[model samples]
Target: MYKHALAAAAAAAFIHLPSTAAEVVTQWNFNSLPADGATGTGTTAAAIGSGTASLVGGATASFASGDASGGSSDPASGDDSGWNLTTFAAQGTGSGTRGAQFAVSTAGFENLVISFDLRHSNTSARHELLQISLDGISFSDFALFDADAGGDRWYTGRTVDLSAVAGASDNASFAFRVVSAFAPTTGQYAATGVGSSYGTSGTWRMDMVTLSGTAIAPVPEPGAMALLLAGLGVIGTVVRRRA
Candidate 1:
């Protein structure tokens, strides 16, 4: 009787095991602002979870008053406002000029995903690189975005999976480091105008950057499952003997 009772309890516990649900670890649409009617260039965006996102590199990052005339469609929210990272010739050239970082705490997620909307007035072939860091200092390249080469203003959506980079950590950080310059002197790229130097020269823009992941559920280890089965077998033998 005791053996059968123990086996039943074991099975019941296994059946009642809770399943883990995935969640949005962090998302930054760059829509929040200070009520004081003041916004800073490097201000951090309010995110969904405990993590925070902030502009790292660039002369200054701010919200666009309106969408670029020839650029990507304005965010569906129609705020006409989105995070803007502007590159100026006055600053160093290339990817070092613009960068943003999104850091999150409490990891152990599967299918880590990231998405962003971007627009640019600069000539095509300008490069945007995405990097991920486990330590928040050393970063490895995760993805890259190249301008359209057409030199027209446009916005486009991009998605990336970072499950490999995210690993099984409980805490991880992702950074978008954009290095840009005047579009190279290529066939159509040359007409875009002088690279970011004189007047409102150098500029790259982005918006609606989001990070998300699904929670990873723990599974019974092989040894544990085997032991449980063995216990059930013993329970069956004991019940048959009693019968």
Candidate 2:
């Protein structure tokens, strides 16, 4: 079976759950303030995807701040750089291009499944890459699968997966890194709109992002629970007096 075959099927079914807690985990999508280096800001109120990077791909990455239903747009500038998105242009047009997005430690989500959805037609290259990371600082490439080519054109879509990053429990963070790594003159890379500064941009466009993961279960770092109980009692007295 195609590596993404399951993802596409799973993608359809995964959106409705609470997404707050689960073994699979995912970005419920937040559409407000931008996640630093993304395309838009917090006011947007749109969810980009799970993981630190924008589920979408680009040069200046795109990220939303809300969930699946309500979200805003995330733009890609230069300043923000943790888990970001960038683009690969061709000739003068960005049509024949590739969208590159990633997961960052700062955005949230720790060790879990992470995947990217892509639409490829006549890919010049065989292996397209979608990977993950533990610290927004370091990176690790995970999967290699062929981009599905429908014709000599590109389409739009999303990507999701379970990641293989390390130290997830301790850091409580991870990142998704995307690169138009294999720069072939023609093929999926080209068809999807990612060519050199001079090649005929192929055709890659991506929209929609999400991040879903069961945050590292609250272990309550040593005795924190005891302190929590004490704090609650104090608040309880205040409520009684107000009543």
Candidate 3:
């Protein structure tokens, strides 16, 4: 009886084990490999995993220094670059319409989370909106970031948690965007700096874009299932004999 109880307890413990630990599903450091010594040169390809990074809403992209304006969260010593984006809509136009987008497959993962480092120019939009899409077509707003501290400085570790969105988990068409948004109440764009005016030429630099989640546990193999069933049978036989 004691052995049967022990076996039962062990099975229960194994069955109730927690989900797998969170892992980086995709990441883009935007830094050049091999220390190219040129901050103006980098790749948009994901540094850690497979994904696509693209400009959205008429925004143009170029590589810029990640070590400028007190630097980003990147630890690379040389050739650390960030994606510099510009060509925003003119003042009082295209609210929430211009910026960058990244698409990644989130299959077999759950509890989605996204993070990035961004630098807003003094003349850039003060309000930035984060949007997500499960179908890769229609997007819904998820979070809004205010660069109230002014621009020409780094804002590291901007994060959005999507653990509550059931469709975000294990989806093949997961995508997200960060776009310039109108001010909360005014319905007009505001400049990042205290006295600066919003402009189409202002830039937004982005680095360390990352997506993470917990991997879904795999189903038990046939051999493992057979072993478990055999163990249960032995435990049942022992209990019956003792009774």
Candidate 4:
């Protein structure tokens, strides 16, 4: 009976092994840290962790209000800013070519997830594609989003689950992009707003861009290992005496 109890306790310890919780690896809030009280002024540097944010395919970027057009998901009450992008490809040209890109190393992490808030202008492309790159050079489409709602509205919580992409975890070159794309089954881009035409001058405002993952637990230290071995030895001695 004592031997059985000891075996049961060992099994319980393995069964209850602690799990790592998901946490934000990197985040781009875009709002100034000191609250400058000006919506037109903000920083592109990540507000949490380290990463790089850049425009892609000749797009121009500026700071814009995250609170405009019904506001974004940002919790900031005042001086909230978002990364605004424009100079998209000409109508019916360069689909999935113009937008923003972000690079963040996922070293020592797994089960990656990406999320953000976006606001579409009236004449912006209705379809947007989320692309991922393991090598940070070539990208592949992972998901597509449609701003079906009328323009000047915030589309919060645009998320992509990359847990199944094994190469995305523990990778130093992981990167992603959100770009305008042609409407599904159509060769041309559709307007975000009804009764409007797609145009290159339209803007996309992004806020609360974040990457998250579960941290890989570190190996036990030498002292911890020694203690564990000593405990196991004690247990074996106890078991032998009981026998």
| Candidate 4 colliding pairs | none
**TM-scores of the models, in the order given:** 0.63, 0.43, 0.87, 0.87
Q: Which stretches of model 2 miss by more than 4 angstroms?
A: 1-20, 23-99, 106-111, 121-126, 151-164, 169-173, 183-200, 220-243
lDDT of 3 at 52: 91
Instruction: Give the higher-lDDT candidate: 1 or 4.
Output: 4
Summarize candidate 2's per-residue lDDT along 111-140 as a digit string, tens digits: 444433333323333235555555555555
Q: Candidate 1: minimum summed lDDT over ten consecutive residues — where? A: 184-193
Candidate 1 wrong stretches, greater than 4 Å: 1-13, 16-22, 33-43, 65-80, 89-97, 123-125, 149-152, 166-169, 173-201, 219-243
* Root-mean-square deviation of Cα positions for candidate 4 versus the true structure, in angstroms: 4.2
Candidate with top lDDT is 4
- Cα lDDT, model 4, residue 145: 98
Q: Give the TM-score of candidate 3.
A: 0.87
lDDT of each: 0.54, 0.40, 0.90, 0.92
| Model 3 lDDT per residue over 104-200, tens place | 9999899899999999999989889999999988888999999989989999999999999979999999999999999988878999988999988
